[model samples]
Target: MTRPKISQMEAYMIETLRASGVTNEAIIQAAKEKDVSTWKQINDQYDFEQLLVLAEQDFSTFEEIINDGYAVKFVTVGGLERLLKLKFQKVEGKDFQKLKTGVQGLDLSGSSLDELKQMLSINWKITKNNEYVSVLLKEKKDFA
Candidate 1:
């Protein structure tokens, strides 16, 4: 019922990755490029180094941490209805059984509203439905 924040959207993406069965180390790596909501107030985080702090105390694995990371994507501004599009990548490990995770998401966290707008090209639009609204920000890869 509350408005969204950057932290909220981040929390949501983390959850999606986990639901996809991503690993802990991979999630931590993703967190370094992204962020998540913490226990302090509604918007405090432990920074990249502290991602595993919770795991240190509890019996957690790379898998377990990701499992706890699912949610609806929300941002700190423009309310919680606006959804941003992002890219995800999976870096495979040496063995076929294991995989390394990498993040390829885009956000304008430190930028101003104008900067955010300038970042948008003419390749995207916004569409809304009764249940949700989303931003389809995209760039044309090639005119060819």
Candidate 2:
């Protein structure tokens, strides 16, 4: 059987994954699992954009990626900043200052979600196990 030809975008994605330290075999496996027949198909079938973002990250370990339910990793200072913005809206003010003070001069690039939660004053929990890490918000009660 002849292998299907990959498009330029597919090639780019593969190269990006490879450059990010993904083994060629792993890339091929991922492509096969997605049944990626063309570049356009890849976008339709997978979170191609997210994958691109992950490629730019510098995750401390592959286990982190595997443990992250979204298969996403944030391993760069910029990536950490983006995550904070997404989760907290504004990365400024007292809460931000508290966070900064908590982790002052510390390297967060390779920190786990649980570790991050511990460093902040957020009322969220990191439900991390051998399988994955999930962030859950605490329920708020209405006071009379």
Candidate 3:
């Protein structure tokens, strides 16, 4: 069967839900319901209002990131570029000078949340904003 054609925004929302630990079965059931109960589930588990705001902000930004053409990799607000910067922050003993000229990027999809936080080097909290970022970081298959 053919897959349903979803907009970038819809995909973003689905991914965000997945990252926030919403099971695919639950999401599918919610979509089937297509009613207030679906929303209630989200509101019960998270700050739904805040999630909407972050999703709106990330919608267009996510499009731009996809167009950069690094394959189907996901990232937060800063996107792939930001992810790359964080991944390479460690200058270490190998080829710092070569890295200065140019560096091959690693596949960031494999990074765990803890690893991502370490790369970001901030007092990372699991906020709505972070949840949206996690959306981009998650594989599309997660929603499928």
Query: For every model shown, what is its TM-score relative to the native structure?
Result: 0.25, 0.24, 0.30
Question: Which of 2 and 3 is the better model by TM-score?
Answer: 3
Best by lDDT: 2
Instruction: Name the regions of candidate 3 deviating beyond 4 angstroms.
Output: 1-4, 36-104, 108-144
lDDT (0 to 1) per candidate = 0.35, 0.37, 0.36
Per-residue lDDT for 11-119 in model 2, tens only?
3354344444556456444443553334344344444544433443533322233233122221233333444444333353422332321212222233445435543
In candidate 1, position 4 carries an lDDT of 19
Clashing pairs in 1: 4-75, 4-76, 5-75, 5-76, 6-76, 9-74, 15-69, 15-70, 24-62
RMSD versus native structure for model 3: 14.9
Residue 5 of model 2 has an lDDT of 29
| Model 1 segments more than 4 A misplaced | 1-46, 72-75, 78-144
Residue 41, candidate 1: alpha-carbon lDDT = 32
RMSD to the hidden true structure, all candidates: 15.9, 16.1, 14.9
lDDT of 3 by residue, 1-144 (tens): 112232333434444565556765555444334332455554364443443443355544433322221122222343323333333342323312112322222222334433444333121222223222321232356445
